[model samples]
Target chain A: MSDSSSILGSTAAPDREAHLTPAANKLYGLMAEFESPAQIVAAAEKVRDAGYRWWDCHTPFPVHGLDQAMGIRATILPVLVFFGGLTGTIAALVLQIFTNAMSFDLWAIVWVRGYDYFISGKPMNSLPAFIPVTFELTVLLASLTVFFGLLLLNGLPRLYHPVFKSQRFARASDDRFFLVIEAKDPQFSRTKTEAMLQALKPLSIEALDS
Target chain B: MSTLVIDNTWDDPAKRAPLVLNHDRFDTVTAEICRVNEEAKPPMAWYVTFGISLALLGLLGVMVMYLLATGVGVWGNQHPVMWGFPIVNFVFWVGIGHAGTLISAILFLFRQKWRTAINRFAEAMTIFAVMCAGIFPAIHVGRIWVIWWVFPIPNQMDMWPQFRSPLIWDVFAVSTYFTVSTLFWYVGLIPDLATLRDRATSKVKAIAYGLFALGWRGSNRHWHRYERAYLLLAALATPLVLSVHSVVSFDFAVSQLPGWHTTIFPPYFVAGAIFSGFAMVVTLAVPARSLWGLKNFITLRHLENMNKIILLTGTIVGYAYAMEFFIAWYSGAIYEQFAFVNRAFGQYAWAYWIMISCNVITPQLFWFKKARTSIWIMFIASLLVNVGMWFERFVIVITTLSQDFLPSSWGYFTPTWVDWLTFLGTFGLFGTFFMLFIRYLPVIAIAEVKGVMPQADPHYGEEGHEHESEHAFGFQPRRPEDKEEDQS
Candidate 1:
């Protein structure tokens, strides 16, 4: 048996399209729900063509090719991660050389002097021996860059998003696929948007607002 | 090419194993994985196991206190056998962590969909196991107070750590490994955490989950970036995993000791690490699946596939053992020959045999499908494999250092009560973290699991919808109270 959560509210506001005043409607957006990926993907393509730049499609997981449907360009996260790794490699290389090969008083909170020495009959500046730490540092910095870069790019650690306003959108992380056309979209006309969403034949539609 | 588990009544061609079984809709997959965390109480066995773990954790605490107060002399580590139980435990626990990384990082790169079911669990195990592993090394330095010397922060002593030493390399490798693994695990948890945040039944749960969820709304724009970052992490971790174990092996291979100084050690150690790590995974997964009703998610196919890897890696381990002996004898060096002969037939011969039979012989049973699929057989074999692996580390450490090249300086390494308790207590440490993890977090990656289901495909509705529609009942929407939970 299904829990109470599984019972979805099917609010079909089809006839309520386009007559309301702008002052009467204070909305985050109109979120159109569909049961399957095919529906939402097909609907996303239409929304993209209609010039809704601020719109987005929400799904439970990474919907393959949905980015293409929404016309999302490939992220520059990997390129940044590469530079991050490069920084780490140079940092490790300099640190090891400065400490192991030559002593220098560097600036931080205080001037800390590097201790140059030799051991294991190996050269004072041993590149082969330094590779392991360098490699690990490269990976460490690259991984950190990927995570922080993603958060910065995505504008995350955000406490709230307007999409969470709709009770229907709760299923966005579960089964439902939602196409949200924000009120802030330049092409947004309250009446015209609902009329366009109606043409997509969504399972349900919600006009969400603060 | 993406593999789809078709509704295989007839006319199916690709014939790959189903990733998720008996679940038609995406939400049910969410429900099942979340149910374990949302339930008010876990099964009775959880309490029993948790209690034992806590008590053992207490023992570990007491032993650490005693060692710090008294001295390193409380352990059996003496002149020749300076690296004893602590090093053995360190290597064993570290090696055990590799399986999780292999599952999470390597398999993900290879696009193995089955990894989604168990990757979270394995990664959690990796972090906890590393924590236990870290404790042994930190304490074994004999001076716990000046442990910061491991770092390159300039000190009043004007002394820096030896950069060319394998020991310093290990410090960097392991700490870096731990940090990267933790970040990787957290990143994977974001979508799943958001699921918990949305479906949270309480205010506290919602806030806590929401904070970590980082306001993930599964937007295509965000998912597009998230997926790319995840791929980058996986790629970075794949090499990190190999390097971590190879650095650990360098702790031995770079040594002048006859048994330890072999070029074969790196690949051999990596293979053994994966072998033992998979063994531990099976051991943990077997009881866990049954206890949590996760059979459908971590299906029989997943277990069978793991058993196949165990068999493959286990054989490689055996071959390495044979090759080590051949390499030792072929070099025609008296000390190398003596080291190999002494390992097989000398003082530590008993421990060597345990390693052989447990690691080599036990996994060979998986060649039979009955052994692979049977819960009892695989579980027992896994337990044996863990024992064998621990002994494998024991044999490598103690045998070489005990007698080595000088018979007069020979010593028999034996564990003191503190040493034994500390080693046993790490299991408790590992178990405690694991128990809390399973109780709180979605034990499986809910979002990743859903991604593999057929319904996630854009064309799922177009292909054979009739077969799925019958079972796609109760597939939509939220509970009445969900709004209050969210708004609160």
Candidate 2:
């Protein structure tokens, strides 16, 4: 069984590579490489005008309005961050209140007294006094929540990506921009997508088979 | 073969890039950059920085050595005034440290593009300021060796730190602040180190950068995780900065002292911290850009923007001052009223006027666009802001301590040589760190700066847009071309 699975996986790798070769379809979607953010954005606008929904823009840095230009909105992470923050707040409040008010008080001396002396004209259980501790707990919990929560929320820790397959993708960190229209987009027909992407006039365009 | 199938549609983590900077960029900078990297060593601006910072540092070192040799009896704290210059300097330095984190973390979280130019240095200033601040408290305790008593340690005596004490909270708050800020600063350095790593030619430089870079290879997955984590840290730090200073303020306000016990101390201290912090940034940045020839990167628009913050925070601080006075008068408390009056006209009245001149009068010039943009004027204003902030602390600590409930105990306090030396020495310590930071670290975030340039962005093409493009990633649009270049 193991040998069969290994054989299947090895065979699939070549099949995947062969499927991604651009020679299979010269009319594949154009992948424009841009040096400037402006070109990517302008091309994105032109593609939008050309009614090409399948095309995408890429850059080393996130181009402003590029998302809106490409008509992208709202990732799944923010809602996740919100829930994480909320949980953090709740957890902080509970833990602090329990620890301070209940858990570990050595009240042997105070227990005999029916009531405790209230100073500064306030009762023993003043909410305001609890504020500092509550706030500290809130911050502590919220911070941990955001950090780890973001990690978990984003489903991270895996260490590979398809963009890494493109050697030029490294320039995204320095001074380069990119835009590609995937074959998967509903509007992506090979010929029309190529025509639409060509009209935008990027620095260079290549067909990316994935 | 009865093979079991696994789900591939669960959002494959393999789709995301592992890191941000790849091997190519790193290799180029490492091998070719120092010689060809025109921006590496712009010109001879360090002479001026070294001269001033070195002199100040020398003064500080001499002062601290004197204090350590002598005792804690030096600067002004007496029987009723257990905490004077040391406490005042602690608060002042801590306040000056606020702007750095506030600018780097809070503004970064808000997606302010203008922050890119100065945030690196600003964050460094924060660390240095905190260092200077941590000193006063440590030394003020006299037997510095036993300062560990402030920590909640399970020792042979079996005594725990008083949980309810504000001073205990401050110990946690300050330590937490320093740790977080250091982490934040180093985390931001990782990418820049990769840039340097790629540029380095010498084996030692390569090793240094490599070690700092921690095997970073600009994989997309790395960027995704890094970006998210950075944002998360920024979010955490913003609240921590606020909370730390608020706890610091609580140290005085929680105590039932005549002028010290006020509800307004937190916001007041926070405002002053931001004000002094901005002033310190301006002071350093104005000189730095001119000295380092970073006119294009650290532009005049950056100065103007910082000035705007200085003006805003300064006003808030001024208002807090006025409010304190008003509250004192409104409450009909003689001691409170007397505290304000005495602050303006007592033995430390000179300090009060200096504070007024620096805090209130100087920043007002920034209301004018011309004044805000002028490097010289901004520098002077920044200097004044520091002086004023110091005096403000002096006024607070001294005035309150000089006169308490009993008129019989009300005696004038003066700083001995020890107090002065330690104060000076701490300044030296801060200057040394800052000087070293500027010399070594990429004082500006190279990648972040490149990100903000006009040509780097995808929207602007070659024709009319002369040079560069900047990217506005998450929130507020960040563009370098939008910045007004520094003429100086």
Candidate 3:
């Protein structure tokens, strides 16, 4: 029974491989495990110089200078957040003014909704009073932008990735630093990429299966 | 081949004190921090405290129900002292909430690395304390059902909450504070939650943690955005913290009352809030560190640093107290002078003295290294500071209300049993939430703690590797005598 099962297992392996598509048969990426962040960073610089677009470095924590090493441009999140804050400030000022200071004229019928009532002898359009809420709203919208902007930019809430299929990828959040050159990269060729990574003297290399 | 000799003097483990002790590895940090959750069974002390907290929370519910069924009169609130315990408690709890934001957001922006150990629990405390703080104003409004009236939503009644009123400003300020703080905290927790999700042994645990993690993979792209978001949130929260308590002060400062009405109130109140908040953090952390076996992570240095903050804020609060008196005298406003005089030596002078002794006098001990480092001293000092902060609010609210310009209306305010119970019950609520937090969540940020370790640096001990390997591998050629002995 054991001999027969072993024979069956041997036969099933090729059958699975044969059933796979060409894209699936090809490696998902070449993942090189570096012993240290500096090693991965140095490797990243070399990879960047070699003009690999679809590649990334993964470390347990963000390594300083790694972004520069990988040649990643600065994100536009700050610009988005700044506009968000500006919108909040303007929106707050308009809301307060329209509600408290300005009268609404609808087809020659003046609505009394924007009643200019005096509060503690202060004018209806008290800009000083408006400042607190304006500041609060500015912060609120800017922070919300920062949060949502991050999620949108990173394309996060992504529950799955091909990288998870590699057994060694789990250590990316622990002790290891990894540089993956995606199969889809223009410069990528299985033998050439493997040889290039091997020349870097990485601790280990794995072909991630999609 | 010329080998690279990396200069690693800056990354030397011996040069810097370890944030995490026992020479922890990355996996060990995860295992240690996650141990409480993995064990799944809390110790007996946790159960006992949690049980007590739940009981107190139940009592608070009962009190609320009773007060709602009757009226605001069920509390000690009366004509002369309408603000009573509810407002005082509101301000006190709100003050307690500030320390968390200060530690997490302010310290983060300042680049204080020590905050990582305690920031998680402190942030949790802020959320829970705000919940407790929020309850008072809602219930204090008497018709808790119509609390939505505070919002600027268009209603058929055609009345907008007076936007100019600082009380209305409070509604915006506090709700905004809660929203921002919760977001900041949850954002920080996401990566840590993913770490927890990956380590979870049970299927149920894995799914639950995984869902909250929002499919975080710790991808480089994700981390880049996360870091940016975190920094912006910290920057945003810093001003929000100062603005929150400043606005809360506006609740009193905008009023006509002698003691409450002052330009100094905003800065004074902000300082007091931070002081009380730090005290509460120390109060919670001391027992928690021992209870959870988290001494190594929440180290003496962290405690000492917190004590130093307490000292600084405590002194500021003291200065504020003196400044109030000097300004009151300098302003030559009879009402202000009377109010200051009455607070220190009037019907409720005992309460004033308690506030002074606890908040001002006791914390001065923290100025000494021995006192700051000593567990017992810090614990007692923290508890006293909490007491002093509570009395400080009471002195501000009750004393001023109890004795106004009209001597005819002046009366001594005394809290009814229900008022005391309700205040005590918030403790239960805060404890219950905190106990649950530590029981389930990663109390210390596992990822953050590991991030600060020496091994996390690529250049750590790079220069010493060859010398260490000689001793470790013993690769020196074996002597001929040793070979002959082996042959014999």
Candidate 4:
């Protein structure tokens, strides 16, 4: 209860903190609110240098350099999407070749045999005829991977987060910038993290509910 | 209007015009865009337009019901001209969707910053237009319920669609196009939905937007992968746009008919798709920006840029027409020559000329800066381009089908009331989706638009942003700080 005691009431001079109220419950993290990208990007550098693992800088938009400032590495999404497309390509080829040119038993609930059907005098195993569908399937699977793959990686469609429990965190989608160092982080401490955040000169720092 | 147009914007790169006008801040952009969705009362035009669209949609539903009950006989697809109004409408709608994907994918790849303001709306248009397009083919099969036969899924009939067939390729092409485009559109929308969720004034608004926002917290960690995923989608969607229209063209070009079979169809159709797609974007944008007070974001410069694209693609379409004629004559194939000559001078010459004038001559007006910047001129030209593109599909489908090789089975295909109403009803379907879109969703890409602003730069204020951002990482060396101020 003492942790969230309107860290607001204690640090009310900044005026920008007028809208920020840290709700009381279990201490989730320490949140530092900033007014601009410059401030947060600078603050992020210090936080990263402080060696906290479970810290994230939130902003209204993707700050151009904040990733580099935080030492974030490039993602493996492109490689994943590439393999995803290859799977689609292989799937399309097997589906077409087996269904149109070769006979094979495909098992589902029961056996469904695919027999070759000769039509329009084309060869039984024509690759040219199959190219269009193959291309479509390649794109379809690659895109699905990008879509679902991105969400799964991001841990999205999560309806609730402890940061969302903070009234000031609403501005994360608006004008303000935020630095959240979760209590679960090994480097996160009551006095030290709050002191490091205070040294960044953010308008306000609040202890959010878990 | 002239003041808003911002002519002479490029005398120097140092004093370039801002993409978002009126010196807007982050909150203002959100406020301006979110106000429309948050407002309890929309303009009376929203009501009137939605009413008309709903009525037209009702007409389409009735016509489709009539067709389903009475059979494809209710429309005028007869012996020679079997691909009548339905095929024409199908190609036209599909082509219209190309602009949306082109804006979202191709322009984004090219790093066109202006697209951020309009891509969301255009992509929404693409999804809706594709939905309208799917209706015709699904119902065109006569046995509406058996339409799944188009896909390769094994049914109890134990049949596979002929992979060698262009029609079967079209089935795969369009369904895949729809699914991928919807994925791309929804992926782009997730961030904005989070904005709406945060800005929600009511519990229902919160729930609706929250469900879609997927608990986005503007996390840089998430954005790192999200940005990569977006780039991947854009790369995938770019070729997908070209292939979709190309495959649709294959439905005609792969056929043996003289007018229908042409190697040039793919490029020509893709060009025309971009041409008409830009036209449709301008057509939707001119009214939307004005209606929603989004003039600051969807500025005239964006419209002018779109007009230039229209001019380019339209001329390409014209060249394709001339090439088609020249190729037909040069082939020394009598049927091909007859197809070209008859198209220009035959009984259906009126439709051919309408296509030429609207698709070719109309966009020529954009060569004049006055026409491109003038809202009225560009809007009318866009409308004309749309009309011309529709007739181009018509001329292609009808001329080729009506008098191909056998004059014995020649039939002048006239669409019944069902065909006319059904086509018009698609407009209703497109409009209804658009109306709903503008009503609830953020029409502009809120975060993306913010990303382009100078304020988004980390070193925005201090030594200016552009200079430091020359580094690929946009990282700048930190300056010595005053420890006294921090300890104050």
lDDT of 1: 0.85
True contacts kept of 1: 0.67
Top TM-score hit: 4
| lDDT (Cα, 0-100) at B4 in candidate 2 | 22
* Runs off by more than 4 Å, candidate 2: A1-60, A63-127, A137-173, A177-210, B1-71, B109-111, B155-158, B462-471, B475-488
**Candidate 1: residue B272 lDDT (0-100):** 94
Better of 1 and 2 by TM-score: 1
Q: Give the per-residue lDDT of model 1 (tens digit) for B9-39.
A: 2224555456788888788888999999999
Candidate lDDT values, in order: 0.85, 0.66, 0.81, 0.85
TM-score of each: 0.92, 0.72, 0.90, 0.93
Weakest ten-residue segment in model 2 chain B by summed lDDT: B16-25
Q: What is the lDDT of residue B309 in candidate 1?
A: 96
Q: What is the lDDT of residue B389 in candidate 3?
A: 96
Per-candidate DockQ vs. reference: 0.39, 0.09, 0.26, 0.39
Count clashes in each candidate, considering only residues at least 3 apart in sequence or on different chains. 2, 47, 0, 0
Ranking by lDDT: 1, 4, 3, 2
What TM-score, to 2 decimals, does candidate 1 have? 0.92
Predicted candidate 4 versus true structure: per-residue lDDT over B1-488, tens digit per residue: 23544443343667656677763479988888999898889999899999999999898889899999999999899878999999999999999999999998888887777798899999999999999998988999999888878877777777888889888888888989999999988988888888888878766677778778888889988877787788888899999999999999999999899898999999999999999888999999999888889888888888989999999999999999999999998999999999989999997999999999999999999998888889999999999999999999999999888998888877787889889989999999999989999998999999888877766767776754462222211223333441111100
| Clash number for candidate 1 | 2
Chain B TM-score, all predictions listed: 0.93, 0.85, 0.92, 0.94
Predicted structure 4: lDDT: 0.85
Q: Per-residue alpha-carbon lDDT of model 4 for A1-210, expressed as tens digits?
A: 112213212323423444565433347799999998889888988887777778888888778777767777666777888999999999999889988998777686556667698988989999998999999999999999999888888887777677776778878888899999999898778998899899999989999756
